[model samples]
Target chain A: EAGVVQSPRYKIIEKKQPVAFWCNPISGHNTLYWYLQNLGQGPELLIRYENEEAVDDSQLPKDRFSAERLKGVDSTLKIQPAELGDSAVYLCASSLGLSSDYQETQYFGPGTRLLVL
Target chain B: AQSVTQLDSQVPVFEEAPVELRCNYSSSVSVYLFWYVQYPNQGLQLLLKYLSGSTLVESINGFEAEFNKSQTSFHLRKPSVHISDTAEYFCAVSARGGDDKIIFGKGTRLHILP
Candidate 1:
């Protein structure tokens, strides 16, 4: 089976501009996650969606960051008025479900590297 | 709050040598531990994980990890490492009965010398 897929693997934009990253989760996966990975650091969860509903988004910056998963298969992460500090790798991951046994593993996409000048 | 710590930023080892990567986690409740590897320009991949039952878990490629409740540590080990083992390894943790939010460590870059 094909793994998770992401588009626009790399993106560059100036500060105050708007940027968006897209992701397609693996087939039959019910949980999708968006994470931000900065240089020399590990990934941090930005938001999580169970099916079409965003079950967790407390870590997302509401002022400038927004995300949505339509049809519970594809997801889009948008950052408006991007700042230099927002430059990082936006990663998308998916899992079979949220059960304790299922949360143990997740498949990750190649990720979109965003550079804000 | 839950957090993970990878004690080493980088580890250099010769081919066919034994290697160990240290990881420690802090959580008030029961936790699940995981190890992930990332290749050049590639996404993270699950190497191994420990949820319950046997405190020891092994990946297909000769890698193993032992979860020690006393030390609060889950360390990754390999009897013999190959050149292709060079990559960034991340340690992660999440609460057992809580939201499935995972927290990752800074990551350790394994450098295999020829």
Candidate 2:
């Protein structure tokens, strides 16, 4: 089966510029997540979507970062007026199970590496 | 809150050498631990996980990890590694009864030299 898909494998932009990253989860997956991975570090969860609803977003920078998963299939993570610190790999992942009782495995996409100068 | 830590940032091992990557977690409640591997220019893939069954778990490609509850550790191990095993491995944990938020540790890069 085809895995989760992400666009723009790499992106470069100057500081204060807005950027958007797109992600399409696996066909049958129900839970979608967005994570940020800085160089030499593991991914940190930015937001999580249970279908069309964003169930968790406490880690998201509300001032500049925003995300949306419409129709519960695809998602878009946006960073407005991004700073140099925003330069990182944006990874998108999806899981098939939504229930907490069953911890399902998450499949990831080829992340979009963003560089802000 | 839960957190994960990978003690080593990088480990260099020769081909056909047995290797182990150490991982430790801290949580107030029960948690599910995972090991994800990322190859060069690729996305992270799940290598193995510990949920609720046996303390030992093995991946299809020969990697194995034992979940030690008392030590609060889940270390990845392989009997013998090949060059193809070179990759960055991440250790992660999420509280079993909490909000399902996963915390990842800084990755450990495995370098296999022939």
* Clash pairs, model 1 backbone: none
Instruction: Give native contacts recovered, as a fraction, per prediction.
Output: 0.59, 0.63
- Residue pairs clashing, model 2: none
lDDT of 2 at A77: 97
Which of the numbered candidates is closest to the native, going by highest DockQ? Answer: 2
> In model 1, where do residues sit more than 4 Å from their true spots?
A98-102
**Tens-place lDDT digits, model 2, residues A1-117:** 899999989999999999999999999898999999998899999998889899899999999999998799999999999999999999999998567532678899999999999
Model 2 spans > 4 angstroms off? none
Model 1 chain A: which ten-residue window has the lowest total lDDT? A96-105
Superposed Cα deviation of residue A96, candidate 1 (Å):
0.7
> What TM-score applies to chain A of candidate 1?
0.95
